[model samples]
Target: MDDRRGSVLVLTNLHDVTTDIVLRVLAARRVPVVRLDPGTDLLAEASLSASYGTGGQRGTLRTPSRDLDLTRVRSVWVRRPSAYDGPPGLDEHDRRFAREQAFWGIGGVLASLPHAHYVNHLWNNRAAEYKPAQLAAAQQVGLLVPDTLITHAAQEAREFVACHGSGVVYKPLWNSPYRVAGRPHSVWVREVREQEITEAVAVCPHLFQARVDKAFDVRVTAVGPWLSGVRIDSPDLDWRRRQGLMRCEPVDVPGAIDQSVRAYLAHFRLVYGAFDFAVTHDGTWYFLECNPNGQWAWQPPDVTDAIAQALADQLEKGSAP
Candidate 1:
Protein backbone atom coordinates (compact mmCIF):
# COMPACT_ATOMS: atom_id res chain seq x y z
CA MET A 1 0.00 0.00 0.00
CA ASP A 2 1.17 3.55 -0.71
CA ASP A 3 1.95 5.09 2.70
CA ARG A 4 0.68 8.56 1.82
CA ARG A 5 -2.49 7.53 0.00
CA GLY A 6 -4.96 7.98 2.88
CA SER A 7 -6.24 11.09 4.69
CA VAL A 8 -4.96 12.66 7.95
CA LEU A 9 -7.85 12.84 10.39
CA VAL A 10 -7.77 15.94 12.65
CA LEU A 11 -9.98 15.98 15.75
CA THR A 12 -10.51 19.51 17.05
CA ASN A 13 -13.12 22.19 17.52
CA LEU A 14 -13.85 24.85 14.86
CA HIS A 15 -12.23 27.89 16.53
CA ASP A 16 -8.77 26.41 16.99
CA VAL A 17 -6.11 28.65 15.40
CA THR A 18 -3.34 26.12 16.11
CA THR A 19 -5.15 23.52 14.01
CA ASP A 20 -5.47 26.05 11.22
CA ILE A 21 -1.71 26.55 11.10
CA VAL A 22 -1.00 22.83 10.83
CA LEU A 23 -3.78 22.40 8.25
CA ARG A 24 -2.15 24.99 6.00
CA VAL A 25 1.14 23.12 6.10
CA LEU A 26 -0.59 19.84 5.29
CA ALA A 27 -2.43 21.54 2.44
CA ALA A 28 0.77 22.94 0.89
CA ARG A 29 2.15 19.41 0.84
CA ARG A 30 -1.02 18.24 -0.98
CA VAL A 31 -1.84 15.71 1.74
CA PRO A 32 -5.44 14.61 2.02
CA VAL A 33 -6.74 15.94 5.37
CA VAL A 34 -10.13 15.49 7.04
CA ARG A 35 -10.93 17.91 9.89
CA LEU A 36 -13.94 17.25 12.08
CA ASP A 37 -15.24 17.94 15.61
CA PRO A 38 -16.87 14.70 16.69
CA GLY A 39 -18.47 16.32 19.73
CA THR A 40 -20.91 18.47 17.82
CA ASP A 41 -20.69 16.97 14.36
CA LEU A 42 -21.86 13.51 15.44
CA LEU A 43 -25.22 14.98 16.46
CA ALA A 44 -26.14 16.09 12.94
CA GLU A 45 -23.36 16.76 10.43
CA ALA A 46 -21.61 13.39 10.82
CA SER A 47 -22.54 9.71 10.71
CA LEU A 48 -20.45 6.64 11.55
CA SER A 49 -20.79 2.88 10.99
CA ALA A 50 -18.25 0.33 12.20
CA SER A 51 -18.23 -3.48 12.33
CA TYR A 52 -15.81 -6.16 13.47
CA GLY A 53 -15.49 -9.90 12.66
CA THR A 54 -13.02 -12.42 11.36
CA GLY A 55 -12.30 -10.21 8.33
CA GLY A 56 -11.20 -7.43 10.76
CA GLN A 57 -12.70 -4.05 11.64
CA ARG A 58 -14.16 -1.81 8.92
CA GLY A 59 -16.16 1.39 8.86
CA THR A 60 -16.98 4.57 6.99
CA LEU A 61 -17.30 7.98 8.66
CA ARG A 62 -19.27 10.55 6.65
CA THR A 63 -19.01 14.23 7.43
CA PRO A 64 -20.70 17.05 5.55
CA SER A 65 -17.54 17.83 3.62
CA ARG A 66 -15.71 14.49 3.44
CA ASP A 67 -16.02 10.71 3.82
CA LEU A 68 -13.28 8.77 5.65
CA ASP A 69 -12.63 5.07 5.07
CA LEU A 70 -11.43 3.86 8.48
CA THR A 71 -8.85 1.48 7.07
CA ARG A 72 -7.42 4.23 4.89
CA VAL A 73 -6.58 6.68 7.69
CA ARG A 74 -2.89 7.52 7.46
CA SER A 75 -2.71 9.40 10.77
CA VAL A 76 -4.82 10.91 13.54
CA TRP A 77 -4.18 14.23 15.31
CA VAL A 78 -6.04 14.30 18.63
CA ARG A 79 -6.23 18.05 19.02
CA ARG A 80 -8.39 20.11 21.34
CA PRO A 81 -11.90 18.70 21.02
CA SER A 82 -15.05 19.59 22.96
CA ALA A 83 -17.06 17.16 25.08
CA TYR A 84 -19.85 15.16 23.49
CA ASP A 85 -23.16 16.70 24.59
CA GLY A 86 -25.46 14.59 22.39
CA PRO A 87 -28.46 15.91 20.39
CA PRO A 88 -30.64 18.73 21.64
CA GLY A 89 -34.16 18.74 23.17
CA LEU A 90 -33.84 15.62 25.29
CA ASP A 91 -34.36 15.03 29.01
CA GLU A 92 -31.17 15.24 31.12
CA HIS A 93 -30.95 11.49 31.69
CA ASP A 94 -31.62 10.68 28.04
CA ARG A 95 -29.02 13.22 26.93
CA ARG A 96 -26.43 11.65 29.20
CA PHE A 97 -27.18 8.22 27.84
CA ALA A 98 -26.97 9.40 24.24
CA ARG A 99 -23.66 11.10 24.87
CA GLU A 100 -22.19 7.96 26.42
CA GLN A 101 -23.31 5.81 23.48
CA ALA A 102 -21.92 8.27 20.96
CA PHE A 103 -18.61 8.49 22.79
CA TRP A 104 -17.94 4.73 23.01
CA GLY A 105 -19.37 3.92 19.57
CA ILE A 106 -17.76 6.72 17.57
CA GLY A 107 -14.70 7.30 19.73
CA GLY A 108 -13.87 3.60 19.96
CA VAL A 109 -13.91 3.17 16.18
CA LEU A 110 -11.75 6.24 15.66
CA ALA A 111 -9.23 4.95 18.16
CA SER A 112 -9.21 1.46 16.60
CA LEU A 113 -8.08 2.54 13.14
CA PRO A 114 -5.29 0.19 12.09
CA HIS A 115 -1.83 1.36 10.91
CA ALA A 116 -2.71 4.95 11.81
CA HIS A 117 -0.24 6.97 13.86
CA TYR A 118 -1.41 9.46 16.47
CA VAL A 119 0.74 12.52 17.09
CA ASN A 120 0.01 11.94 20.78
CA HIS A 121 -2.32 9.00 21.21
CA LEU A 122 -5.52 9.88 23.12
CA TRP A 123 -4.92 7.31 25.86
CA ASN A 124 -1.33 8.42 26.37
CA ASN A 125 -2.38 12.05 26.44
CA ARG A 126 -4.95 11.37 29.13
CA ALA A 127 -2.48 9.39 31.22
CA ALA A 128 0.25 12.01 30.88
CA GLU A 129 -1.95 14.85 32.08
CA TYR A 130 -1.22 13.99 35.72
CA LYS A 131 1.52 16.25 37.12
CA PRO A 132 2.71 13.56 39.52
CA ALA A 133 3.42 11.14 36.69
CA GLN A 134 5.16 13.87 34.71
CA LEU A 135 7.45 14.78 37.58
CA ALA A 136 8.29 11.15 38.31
CA ALA A 137 9.09 10.52 34.65
CA ALA A 138 11.27 13.60 34.46
CA GLN A 139 13.24 12.56 37.53
CA GLN A 140 13.72 9.05 36.19
CA VAL A 141 14.90 10.46 32.84
CA GLY A 142 17.61 12.61 34.57
CA LEU A 143 15.79 15.96 34.63
CA LEU A 144 15.89 18.27 37.66
CA VAL A 145 12.58 18.67 39.46
CA PRO A 146 11.82 20.90 42.43
CA ASP A 147 10.92 19.65 45.92
CA THR A 148 7.17 19.19 45.61
CA LEU A 149 4.33 18.18 47.89
CA ILE A 150 0.73 17.18 47.26
CA THR A 151 -1.45 17.09 50.37
CA HIS A 152 -4.94 17.64 51.70
CA ALA A 153 -3.79 18.23 55.27
CA ALA A 154 -3.34 21.77 56.52
CA GLN A 155 -0.53 20.81 58.89
CA GLU A 156 1.39 19.06 56.12
CA ALA A 157 1.08 22.04 53.78
CA ARG A 158 2.24 24.38 56.55
CA GLU A 159 5.25 22.17 57.27
CA PHE A 160 6.13 21.96 53.60
CA VAL A 161 6.06 25.75 53.26
CA ALA A 162 8.22 26.26 56.38
CA CYS A 163 10.84 23.71 55.25
CA HIS A 164 11.49 25.67 52.09
CA GLY A 165 13.12 28.74 53.61
CA SER A 166 13.64 30.41 50.25
CA GLY A 167 9.91 30.22 49.41
CA VAL A 168 7.15 27.96 48.12
CA VAL A 169 4.69 28.38 45.26
CA TYR A 170 1.16 27.08 44.92
CA LYS A 171 -0.11 25.77 41.60
CA PRO A 172 -3.23 23.94 40.59
CA LEU A 173 -2.83 20.29 39.67
CA TRP A 174 -5.27 20.85 36.79
CA ASN A 175 -6.59 24.00 35.18
CA SER A 176 -10.28 23.26 35.26
CA PRO A 177 -12.63 25.98 34.03
CA TYR A 178 -13.24 28.61 36.70
CA ARG A 179 -15.23 31.82 36.47
CA VAL A 180 -15.92 34.77 38.69
CA ALA A 181 -18.61 37.32 37.89
CA GLY A 182 -19.27 35.47 34.65
CA ARG A 183 -15.71 36.04 33.41
CA PRO A 184 -13.23 33.20 33.06
CA HIS A 185 -10.31 33.11 35.47
CA SER A 186 -7.16 30.99 35.76
CA VAL A 187 -5.23 29.82 38.80
CA TRP A 188 -1.72 31.12 38.13
CA VAL A 189 1.38 30.08 40.07
CA ARG A 190 2.10 32.41 42.97
CA GLU A 191 4.24 32.53 46.04
CA VAL A 192 2.61 31.22 49.20
CA ARG A 193 3.24 32.10 52.85
CA GLU A 194 2.81 29.78 55.79
CA GLN A 195 -0.04 31.87 57.12
CA GLU A 196 -1.94 31.37 53.85
CA ILE A 197 -2.06 27.62 54.45
CA THR A 198 -5.28 27.50 56.40
CA GLU A 199 -8.12 25.03 56.96
CA ALA A 200 -9.15 25.53 53.35
CA VAL A 201 -6.17 23.42 52.36
CA ALA A 202 -7.76 20.48 54.13
CA VAL A 203 -10.71 20.54 51.74
CA CYS A 204 -8.82 19.25 48.71
CA PRO A 205 -5.44 18.08 47.52
CA HIS A 206 -3.04 20.98 46.84
CA LEU A 207 0.31 21.08 45.08
CA PHE A 208 3.13 23.09 46.60
CA GLN A 209 6.75 23.26 45.51
CA ALA A 210 9.94 25.02 46.55
CA ARG A 211 10.20 28.09 44.34
CA VAL A 212 12.94 28.13 41.72
CA ASP A 213 15.16 31.19 41.84
CA LYS A 214 15.52 31.42 38.10
CA ALA A 215 17.11 33.95 35.76
CA PHE A 216 14.63 33.20 32.93
CA ASP A 217 12.22 30.58 31.63
CA VAL A 218 12.33 28.13 28.73
CA ARG A 219 9.52 26.65 26.68
CA VAL A 220 10.67 23.58 24.78
CA THR A 221 8.24 22.40 22.12
CA ALA A 222 9.01 18.86 21.02
CA VAL A 223 7.55 17.27 17.88
CA GLY A 224 8.76 13.71 17.40
CA PRO A 225 12.55 13.86 17.07
CA TRP A 226 12.66 17.64 16.57
CA LEU A 227 12.80 20.18 19.40
CA SER A 228 12.55 23.98 19.41
CA GLY A 229 13.50 25.89 22.55
CA VAL A 230 12.35 29.45 23.19
CA ARG A 231 13.93 31.60 25.91
CA ILE A 232 11.38 33.90 27.53
CA ASP A 233 12.57 36.91 29.55
CA SER A 234 9.86 38.34 31.71
CA PRO A 235 9.64 40.32 34.97
CA ASP A 236 6.72 38.31 36.35
CA LEU A 237 6.57 35.17 38.45
CA ASP A 238 4.33 33.56 35.84
CA TRP A 239 5.31 34.69 32.33
CA ARG A 240 1.92 33.72 30.97
CA ARG A 241 0.33 36.59 32.92
CA ARG A 242 2.33 39.14 30.90
CA GLN A 243 2.86 37.35 27.62
CA GLY A 244 2.50 40.64 25.77
CA LEU A 245 5.46 42.14 27.66
CA MET A 246 7.77 39.13 27.49
CA ARG A 247 10.66 38.82 25.04
CA CYS A 248 11.01 35.51 23.22
CA GLU A 249 13.91 34.28 21.10
CA PRO A 250 15.17 30.94 19.82
CA VAL A 251 17.74 29.16 21.99
CA ASP A 252 19.91 26.14 21.42
CA VAL A 253 18.92 23.11 23.49
CA PRO A 254 21.77 21.58 25.49
CA GLY A 255 22.86 18.06 24.53
CA ALA A 256 21.90 16.46 27.87
CA ILE A 257 18.52 18.18 28.06
CA ASP A 258 17.70 17.13 24.53
CA GLN A 259 18.45 13.49 25.30
CA SER A 260 16.34 13.54 28.48
CA VAL A 261 13.46 15.22 26.63
CA ARG A 262 13.35 12.53 23.98
CA ALA A 263 13.50 9.89 26.69
CA TYR A 264 10.74 11.60 28.63
CA LEU A 265 8.46 11.63 25.58
CA ALA A 266 9.15 7.99 24.95
CA HIS A 267 8.37 7.20 28.58
CA PHE A 268 4.92 8.68 28.14
CA ARG A 269 4.40 7.32 24.62
CA LEU A 270 3.93 10.84 23.33
CA VAL A 271 5.07 12.15 19.96
CA TYR A 272 4.52 15.82 20.90
CA GLY A 273 4.91 17.79 24.13
CA ALA A 274 5.34 21.39 25.32
CA PHE A 275 7.67 21.44 28.32
CA ASP A 276 8.19 24.37 30.71
CA PHE A 277 11.43 24.81 32.61
CA ALA A 278 12.95 27.36 34.99
CA VAL A 279 16.60 28.10 34.32
CA THR A 280 18.85 29.43 37.08
CA HIS A 281 21.63 31.99 36.68
CA ASP A 282 24.18 29.17 37.00
CA GLY A 283 22.49 27.34 34.05
CA THR A 284 20.27 24.65 35.58
CA TRP A 285 16.93 23.72 34.00
CA TYR A 286 14.19 22.76 36.47
CA PHE A 287 11.41 20.59 35.08
CA LEU A 288 8.04 22.19 35.71
CA GLU A 289 5.46 20.31 33.62
CA CYS A 290 4.69 19.01 30.17
CA ASN A 291 1.43 19.61 28.32
CA PRO A 292 1.01 16.75 25.86
CA ASN A 293 -1.04 18.92 23.50
CA GLY A 294 0.00 22.43 24.44
CA GLN A 295 -0.07 25.40 22.07
CA TRP A 296 2.99 26.18 19.92
CA ALA A 297 1.72 28.46 17.15
CA TRP A 298 1.96 31.44 19.53
CA GLN A 299 5.75 31.51 19.22
CA PRO A 300 7.75 33.66 16.79
CA PRO A 301 7.13 33.15 13.07
CA ASP A 302 10.20 31.07 12.21
CA VAL A 303 9.83 28.81 15.22
CA THR A 304 6.13 28.26 14.63
CA ASP A 305 6.74 27.52 10.96
CA ALA A 306 9.40 24.96 11.85
CA ILE A 307 7.10 23.19 14.30
CA ALA A 308 4.22 23.13 11.82
CA GLN A 309 6.44 21.67 9.12
CA ALA A 310 7.78 18.98 11.43
CA LEU A 311 4.23 18.02 12.41
CA ALA A 312 3.13 17.91 8.79
CA ASP A 313 6.08 15.71 7.95
CA GLN A 314 5.11 13.21 10.65
CA LEU A 315 1.48 13.16 9.56
CA GLU A 316 2.41 12.74 5.89
CA LYS A 317 4.81 9.91 6.65
CA GLY A 318 2.01 8.08 8.46
CA SER A 319 2.61 5.02 10.64
CA ALA A 320 4.74 1.94 10.00
CA PRO A 321 3.10 -1.49 10.00
Candidate 2:
Protein backbone atom coordinates (compact mmCIF):
# COMPACT_ATOMS: atom_id res chain seq x y z
CA MET A 1 0.00 0.00 0.00
CA ASP A 2 1.39 3.40 -0.92
CA ASP A 3 1.41 6.03 1.82
CA ARG A 4 0.98 8.98 -0.56
CA ARG A 5 -2.32 8.00 -2.23
CA GLY A 6 -5.49 6.90 -0.41
CA SER A 7 -8.81 5.19 -1.23
CA VAL A 8 -12.46 6.12 -0.98
CA LEU A 9 -14.23 4.40 1.96
CA VAL A 10 -17.90 3.56 1.47
CA LEU A 11 -19.99 2.66 4.53
CA THR A 12 -22.96 0.81 3.11
CA ASN A 13 -25.32 -2.13 3.38
CA LEU A 14 -23.71 -5.26 1.92
CA HIS A 15 -26.36 -5.72 -0.78
CA ASP A 16 -26.67 -2.05 -1.72
CA VAL A 17 -26.79 -1.56 -5.51
CA THR A 18 -25.42 2.00 -5.37
CA THR A 19 -22.27 0.54 -3.90
CA ASP A 20 -21.51 -1.04 -7.27
CA ILE A 21 -22.12 2.26 -9.07
CA VAL A 22 -19.63 4.12 -6.87
CA LEU A 23 -17.03 1.34 -6.91
CA ARG A 24 -17.12 1.09 -10.68
CA VAL A 25 -16.65 4.83 -11.11
CA LEU A 26 -13.59 4.93 -8.87
CA ALA A 27 -12.08 1.87 -10.58
CA ALA A 28 -12.59 3.47 -13.97
CA ARG A 29 -10.61 6.47 -12.76
CA ARG A 30 -7.87 4.20 -11.33
CA VAL A 31 -8.63 5.54 -7.87
CA PRO A 32 -8.07 2.99 -5.07
CA VAL A 33 -11.28 2.23 -3.18
CA VAL A 34 -12.18 0.60 0.15
CA ARG A 35 -15.70 -0.70 0.52
CA LEU A 36 -16.67 -2.21 3.85
CA ASP A 37 -19.79 -2.89 5.90
CA PRO A 38 -19.70 -0.81 9.11
CA GLY A 39 -20.35 -3.94 11.19
CA THR A 40 -17.33 -5.93 10.11
CA ASP A 41 -14.30 -6.85 12.23
CA LEU A 42 -12.19 -4.95 9.71
CA LEU A 43 -14.00 -1.73 10.61
CA ALA A 44 -13.37 -2.29 14.30
CA GLU A 45 -9.76 -3.17 13.70
CA ALA A 46 -9.25 -0.04 11.63
CA SER A 47 -11.13 2.06 14.16
CA LEU A 48 -8.84 0.88 16.96
CA SER A 49 -5.68 1.58 14.95
CA ALA A 50 -4.84 -2.09 14.55
CA SER A 51 -3.14 -3.21 11.32
CA TYR A 52 -5.68 -3.66 8.49
CA GLY A 53 -5.91 -3.70 4.67
CA THR A 54 -5.63 -6.92 2.69
CA GLY A 55 -5.25 -6.05 -0.99
CA GLY A 56 -8.08 -6.63 -3.50
CA GLN A 57 -9.88 -4.69 -6.23
CA ARG A 58 -10.93 -2.50 -3.28
CA GLY A 59 -7.22 -1.86 -2.85
CA THR A 60 -4.85 -1.60 0.15
CA LEU A 61 -6.59 0.15 3.09
CA ARG A 62 -5.14 -0.39 6.52
CA THR A 63 -4.67 1.02 9.99
CA PRO A 64 -1.35 0.27 11.66
CA SER A 65 -0.40 1.55 15.10
CA ARG A 66 0.46 4.67 13.15
CA ASP A 67 -2.21 7.24 12.41
CA LEU A 68 -3.83 7.27 8.97
CA ASP A 69 -2.38 9.91 6.66
CA LEU A 70 -5.62 11.76 6.02
CA THR A 71 -3.96 14.12 3.52
CA ARG A 72 -3.69 11.11 1.25
CA VAL A 73 -7.39 10.23 1.63
CA ARG A 74 -9.30 12.25 -1.00
CA SER A 75 -12.85 11.63 0.17
CA VAL A 76 -15.32 9.36 2.00
CA TRP A 77 -18.85 8.45 0.92
CA VAL A 78 -21.22 7.02 3.53
CA ARG A 79 -24.26 5.27 2.10
CA ARG A 80 -26.90 3.36 4.07
CA PRO A 81 -24.98 1.34 6.67
CA SER A 82 -27.18 -1.20 8.41
CA ALA A 83 -26.81 -2.33 12.00
CA TYR A 84 -24.23 -4.90 12.93
CA ASP A 85 -25.03 -8.59 12.67
CA GLY A 86 -22.68 -9.93 15.32
CA PRO A 87 -20.18 -12.65 14.62
CA PRO A 88 -21.23 -16.03 15.98
CA GLY A 89 -20.09 -17.45 19.36
CA LEU A 90 -20.23 -14.30 21.41
CA ASP A 91 -22.54 -13.92 24.40
CA GLU A 92 -25.07 -11.13 24.36
CA HIS A 93 -22.83 -8.95 26.56
CA ASP A 94 -19.84 -9.29 24.22
CA ARG A 95 -22.02 -8.62 21.23
CA ARG A 96 -23.39 -5.45 22.77
CA PHE A 97 -19.91 -4.31 23.76
CA ALA A 98 -18.57 -4.71 20.23
CA ARG A 99 -21.58 -3.12 18.60
CA GLU A 100 -21.71 -0.06 20.84
CA GLN A 101 -17.99 0.64 20.57
CA ALA A 102 -18.01 0.05 16.86
CA PHE A 103 -20.80 2.56 16.39
CA TRP A 104 -19.05 5.49 18.12
CA GLY A 105 -15.53 4.43 17.23
CA ILE A 106 -15.82 4.73 13.47
CA GLY A 107 -17.37 8.18 13.61
CA GLY A 108 -14.85 9.32 16.19
CA VAL A 109 -11.88 8.28 14.09
CA LEU A 110 -13.20 9.69 10.85
CA ALA A 111 -14.14 12.99 12.48
CA SER A 112 -10.66 13.43 13.91
CA LEU A 113 -9.02 12.95 10.56
CA PRO A 114 -8.03 16.35 9.10
CA HIS A 115 -8.27 16.12 5.32
CA ALA A 116 -10.96 13.65 4.31
CA HIS A 117 -13.86 15.41 2.60
CA TYR A 118 -16.79 13.42 3.90
CA VAL A 119 -19.64 13.49 1.38
CA ASN A 120 -21.80 14.21 4.40
CA HIS A 121 -20.12 14.12 7.76
CA LEU A 122 -21.63 11.41 9.97
CA TRP A 123 -22.16 13.78 12.92
CA ASN A 124 -24.04 16.25 10.74
CA ASN A 125 -26.14 13.41 9.37
CA ARG A 126 -27.04 12.24 12.87
CA ALA A 127 -28.11 15.73 13.94
CA ALA A 128 -30.15 16.36 10.79
CA GLU A 129 -32.24 13.23 11.40
CA TYR A 130 -34.68 15.36 13.41
CA LYS A 131 -37.64 16.27 11.21
CA PRO A 132 -38.08 19.60 12.98
CA ALA A 133 -34.50 20.55 12.18
CA GLN A 134 -34.95 19.70 8.52
CA LEU A 135 -38.22 21.62 8.22
CA ALA A 136 -36.77 24.61 10.01
CA ALA A 137 -33.77 24.65 7.70
CA ALA A 138 -36.02 24.53 4.68
CA GLN A 139 -38.18 27.37 5.91
CA GLN A 140 -35.13 29.47 6.79
CA VAL A 141 -34.02 29.23 3.19
CA GLY A 142 -37.39 30.65 1.97
CA LEU A 143 -38.95 27.43 0.77
CA LEU A 144 -42.71 27.07 1.25
CA VAL A 145 -43.55 24.48 3.90
CA PRO A 146 -46.75 22.74 4.94
CA ASP A 147 -48.47 23.58 8.21
CA THR A 148 -47.04 21.24 10.86
CA LEU A 149 -47.44 20.44 14.52
CA ILE A 150 -45.55 18.13 16.87
CA THR A 151 -47.11 17.38 20.18
CA HIS A 152 -47.29 14.77 22.92
CA ALA A 153 -50.73 15.83 24.14
CA ALA A 154 -53.66 14.22 22.38
CA GLN A 155 -55.86 17.27 22.69
CA GLU A 156 -53.22 19.40 20.99
CA ALA A 157 -53.08 16.88 18.18
CA ARG A 158 -56.86 16.93 17.91
CA GLU A 159 -56.89 20.70 17.69
CA PHE A 160 -54.26 20.71 14.97
CA VAL A 161 -56.14 18.04 13.05
CA ALA A 162 -59.34 20.03 13.32
CA CYS A 163 -57.58 23.01 11.75
CA HIS A 164 -55.91 20.97 9.00
CA GLY A 165 -59.08 18.99 8.27
CA SER A 166 -59.44 15.29 7.53
CA GLY A 167 -56.55 15.65 5.11
CA VAL A 168 -54.22 15.65 8.13
CA VAL A 169 -51.46 13.02 8.15
CA TYR A 170 -49.28 11.40 10.77
CA LYS A 171 -45.61 10.58 10.42
CA PRO A 172 -42.90 9.06 12.61
CA LEU A 173 -40.67 11.41 14.62
CA TRP A 174 -37.66 9.37 13.53
CA ASN A 175 -37.01 6.77 10.91
CA SER A 176 -38.58 3.62 12.35
CA PRO A 177 -38.61 0.02 11.33
CA TYR A 178 -42.01 -0.92 9.95
CA ARG A 179 -43.34 -4.40 10.48
CA VAL A 180 -46.50 -6.37 9.88
CA ALA A 181 -47.38 -9.96 10.82
CA GLY A 182 -43.85 -10.43 12.25
CA ARG A 183 -42.15 -9.21 9.11
CA PRO A 184 -40.68 -5.87 7.91
CA HIS A 185 -42.81 -3.13 6.36
CA SER A 186 -42.57 0.48 5.19
CA VAL A 187 -44.74 3.51 6.05
CA TRP A 188 -46.87 5.19 3.38
CA VAL A 189 -48.64 8.56 3.45
CA ARG A 190 -52.38 8.31 4.09
CA GLU A 191 -55.19 10.66 5.10
CA VAL A 192 -56.15 10.62 8.77
CA ARG A 193 -59.54 11.03 10.36
CA GLU A 194 -60.37 12.60 13.73
CA GLN A 195 -61.16 9.12 15.00
CA GLU A 196 -57.78 7.85 13.83
CA ILE A 197 -56.13 10.36 16.16
CA THR A 198 -57.58 8.35 19.07
CA GLU A 199 -54.87 7.51 21.59
CA ALA A 200 -52.16 8.19 18.98
CA VAL A 201 -50.35 10.73 21.17
CA ALA A 202 -50.44 8.46 24.21
CA VAL A 203 -47.60 6.41 22.74
CA CYS A 204 -45.38 9.33 21.73
CA PRO A 205 -45.40 12.74 20.07
CA HIS A 206 -46.65 11.92 16.59
CA LEU A 207 -45.87 14.28 13.72
CA PHE A 208 -49.01 15.73 12.10
CA GLN A 209 -49.19 17.94 9.06
CA ALA A 210 -51.73 19.12 6.52
CA ARG A 211 -51.60 16.69 3.62
CA VAL A 212 -50.94 18.89 0.60
CA ASP A 213 -53.36 18.15 -2.24
CA LYS A 214 -50.86 17.73 -5.02
CA ALA A 215 -50.78 17.29 -8.78
CA PHE A 216 -47.49 15.42 -8.48
CA ASP A 217 -44.35 14.70 -6.42
CA VAL A 218 -40.90 16.13 -7.17
CA ARG A 219 -37.76 14.26 -6.23
CA VAL A 220 -34.61 16.42 -6.13
CA THR A 221 -31.29 14.61 -6.29
CA ALA A 222 -28.48 17.04 -5.33
CA VAL A 223 -24.95 15.96 -6.10
CA GLY A 224 -22.85 19.04 -5.56
CA PRO A 225 -24.51 21.55 -7.95
CA TRP A 226 -25.74 18.82 -10.26
CA LEU A 227 -29.34 18.72 -8.98
CA SER A 228 -31.64 16.77 -11.31
CA GLY A 229 -34.66 14.41 -11.45
CA VAL A 230 -38.38 14.26 -12.41
CA ARG A 231 -41.89 14.90 -11.18
CA ILE A 232 -43.97 11.81 -10.36
CA ASP A 233 -47.75 11.55 -10.62
CA SER A 234 -49.65 9.03 -8.55
CA PRO A 235 -53.15 8.77 -7.10
CA ASP A 236 -51.91 7.56 -3.74
CA LEU A 237 -51.11 10.12 -1.06
CA ASP A 238 -47.64 8.65 -0.79
CA TRP A 239 -45.98 7.99 -4.12
CA ARG A 240 -43.93 5.28 -2.45
CA ARG A 241 -47.12 3.41 -1.62
CA ARG A 242 -48.28 3.60 -5.24
CA GLN A 243 -45.12 2.15 -6.74
CA GLY A 244 -47.13 0.51 -9.51
CA LEU A 245 -49.62 3.39 -9.88
CA MET A 246 -47.32 6.23 -10.83
CA ARG A 247 -45.73 7.96 -13.81
CA CYS A 248 -42.38 9.78 -13.78
CA GLU A 249 -41.16 12.35 -16.28
CA PRO A 250 -38.30 14.82 -16.42
CA VAL A 251 -39.33 18.26 -15.18
CA ASP A 252 -37.57 21.57 -14.64
CA VAL A 253 -36.88 22.34 -10.98
CA PRO A 254 -37.66 26.02 -10.37
CA GLY A 255 -34.66 28.26 -9.69
CA ALA A 256 -35.83 29.36 -6.24
CA ILE A 257 -36.40 25.81 -5.11
CA ASP A 258 -33.01 24.87 -6.54
CA GLN A 259 -31.32 27.66 -4.56
CA SER A 260 -33.11 26.66 -1.38
CA VAL A 261 -32.05 23.07 -1.81
CA ARG A 262 -28.45 24.18 -2.26
CA ALA A 263 -28.61 26.28 0.90
CA TYR A 264 -30.12 23.34 2.81
CA LEU A 265 -27.24 21.12 1.71
CA ALA A 266 -24.70 23.79 2.67
CA HIS A 267 -26.31 24.18 6.09
CA PHE A 268 -25.89 20.48 6.71
CA ARG A 269 -22.43 20.41 5.02
CA LEU A 270 -23.50 17.61 2.69
CA VAL A 271 -22.72 16.97 -0.94
CA TYR A 272 -25.86 14.93 -1.67
CA GLY A 273 -29.52 14.97 -0.68
CA ALA A 274 -32.63 13.15 -1.96
CA PHE A 275 -35.38 15.68 -1.30
CA ASP A 276 -39.16 15.20 -1.49
CA PHE A 277 -41.42 18.04 -2.55
CA ALA A 278 -45.13 18.37 -3.21
CA VAL A 279 -46.52 20.44 -6.07
CA THR A 280 -50.07 21.53 -5.36
CA HIS A 281 -53.02 22.05 -7.74
CA ASP A 282 -52.07 25.73 -8.07
CA GLY A 283 -48.44 24.85 -8.77
CA THR A 284 -47.26 25.92 -5.33
CA TRP A 285 -44.24 23.91 -4.19
CA TYR A 286 -44.00 22.83 -0.56
CA PHE A 287 -40.97 21.46 1.20
CA LEU A 288 -41.41 17.91 2.36
CA GLU A 289 -38.19 16.41 3.77
CA CYS A 290 -34.60 15.71 2.83
CA ASN A 291 -32.90 12.35 3.13
CA PRO A 292 -29.20 13.27 3.50
CA ASN A 293 -27.77 10.00 2.25
CA GLY A 294 -30.89 8.80 0.45
CA GLN A 295 -30.83 6.27 -2.38
CA TRP A 296 -30.30 7.59 -5.93
CA ALA A 297 -29.61 4.30 -7.72
CA TRP A 298 -33.34 3.53 -7.96
CA GLN A 299 -33.82 6.41 -10.39
CA PRO A 300 -33.36 5.78 -14.12
CA PRO A 301 -29.90 4.55 -15.14
CA ASP A 302 -28.90 7.85 -16.78
CA VAL A 303 -29.67 9.77 -13.59
CA THR A 304 -27.74 7.28 -11.48
CA ASP A 305 -24.80 7.50 -13.85
CA ALA A 306 -24.73 11.30 -13.59
CA ILE A 307 -24.75 11.18 -9.77
CA ALA A 308 -21.87 8.73 -9.81
CA GLN A 309 -19.97 11.01 -12.14
CA ALA A 310 -20.58 14.06 -9.96
CA LEU A 311 -19.22 12.20 -6.94
CA ALA A 312 -16.09 11.17 -8.84
CA ASP A 313 -15.62 14.75 -9.96
CA GLN A 314 -15.68 15.96 -6.37
CA LEU A 315 -13.15 13.33 -5.33
CA GLU A 316 -10.71 14.30 -8.05
CA LYS A 317 -11.20 18.03 -7.57
CA GLY A 318 -10.58 17.72 -3.83
CA SER A 319 -7.36 15.81 -4.36
CA ALA A 320 -4.04 17.70 -4.03
CA PRO A 321 -3.67 19.87 -7.13
Best by TM-score: 1
lDDT of 2 by residue, 125-230 (tens): 8777789999999999999989998888888888888887537987777768978999998876667777667775788777889988888899999988789967
> What would the TM-score be for candidate 1 when compared with the true structure?
0.98
- Model 1: per-residue Cα lDDT over 1-321, one tens digit each: 565798999999989989999899999989999888889887877888888999888889898887888889999999988888988999999999999998888788878888899988888998999999999999999999999999999999999999999899999999989999999998899999999889998888999999999999999999999898999999899999888999999998899999999999999999999999999999999999999999888799999999999999889999975
Candidates in order have lDDT scores of: 0.92, 0.75
After TM-score superposition, what is the CA distance of residue 81 in candidate 1 from its true location, in Å?
1.0
Query: What lDDT score is found at residue 124 in candidate 1?
Result: 93
The residue pairs found clashing in candidate 2 are: none
> Model 2 — which ten-residue stretch has the worst lDDT?
50-59
Q: Candidate 2, 242: how far from true, in Å?
A: 3.5
Candidate 2 deviant stretches above 4 angstroms: 1-5, 41-71, 85-87, 319-321
